[model samples]
Target: MAVARLGTVVLDCPDPLALAAFYAEIIGGKAEETEEGWVELTGHEGTPLAFQKSPGYVPPRWPAEDGSQQFHLDLTVEDLDAAETRVLALGAKAVDAGDPVRTWRVYTDIAGHPFCLCAC
Candidate 1:
């Protein structure tokens, strides 16, 4: 009864290869540049992700009044602390350091896209 199945989540960034590499590190995928200005990450656990080159890419701002964060990815992890440490070292900037009781923490990728590491 579903209209269609999900194909892939594509993001527009300045450099497709670089963004794909960043996500590949977090999601256990191998990034391959399939075509000019386009890169695909495969062999990952979850849904596939692809990156496309944008000439004048401007990242969205978090906690904006107008909901600048159009969308975000929620990644499930076992240990939030351990995952936080690894993502930080991979050039992800912390957007919100959730409280101790919180189950999720927010961060921005190299391209400034918001994503959450949720404790599972």
Candidate 2:
């Protein structure tokens, strides 16, 4: 049996509202800020995604030999090329680890958190 029900997945970032807006664009949600300064992406299907304000935030490094990537979100999309283009336009920088053959491409958000757009 499960110990508890999952509530929401929260990410720590410098600007909660900004990060929320960025993910909202990609995942189809409305970025709503709370009185506590935390931002939540609402009205989307699946598990909820929220952002918390973290002062002096330092984003994790991806593809590091030391395994610096603490965590990452894998977003499945119908069109990988289109999604990559759109995310890049939204200030997502691509992380080229030099692996040519792969179904998923890595990218970092404006706040520098690593994420991937996997082909569905």
Candidate 3:
């Protein structure tokens, strides 16, 4: 038997509710405010994502030494082009990694957390 199972991935941001809502919309879930500065997205078709407020939160500067991204999420999609359009409309900033033919593309969320949309 396994010693443990994955629960939720919590992200620190300036606004918990907003971050929770953003992930909820992308991942198919409902955002619930448990308390001030805390929110949870549950019932997603995938894993649950939670958000916690950090007053001094500094968005990670991807591709840079200072405040570099700690981690990222890779989401598989059937249609990369379509997904990219939608994500961009939802405030995702595409990262110019200069590998157009790759199976995955990187983007940063509103709070500057790096994530990827993968075709594989």
Return the top candidate by TM-score: 1
Model 2: residues with Cα > 4 Å off, grouped in runs? 97-101
Rate residue 18 of model 3 by lDDT: 80
Q: Would you give me the overall lDDT of model 3?
A: 0.85
The clash count for each model shown is: 0, 0, 0
Q: Which regions in candidate 3 have their CA more than 4 angstroms from the true location? A: 66-68
* lDDT score for candidate 2 against the true structure: 0.89
**Residues 1-120, model 3: lDDT tens digits:** 999999888899998988887877777788899888889888877777889999999887777776557798988888888888888988999985347677888899999998999996
Among all windows of 10 consecutive residues in model 1, the one with the lowest summed lDDT is 60-69
Best by lDDT: 1
Task: Report how far off residue 120 is in candidate 2 (Å).
Answer: 0.6
What's the CA error at residue 116 for candidate 1, in Å? 0.2
- Per-residue lDDT over 31-85 for candidate 2, one digit per residue giving the tens place of the 0 to 100 score: 9987576999999988999999999788888877877788899999998889989
lDDT scores in order: 0.92, 0.89, 0.85
Query: Which of 2 and 3 is ahead in TM-score?
Result: 2
TM-score of each: 0.96, 0.92, 0.89
How do these models rank on lDDT, best leading?
1, 2, 3
In model 2, which residue pairs have backbone atoms overlapping below 3 Å? none
Give the Å shift of residue 93 in candidate 3: 0.5
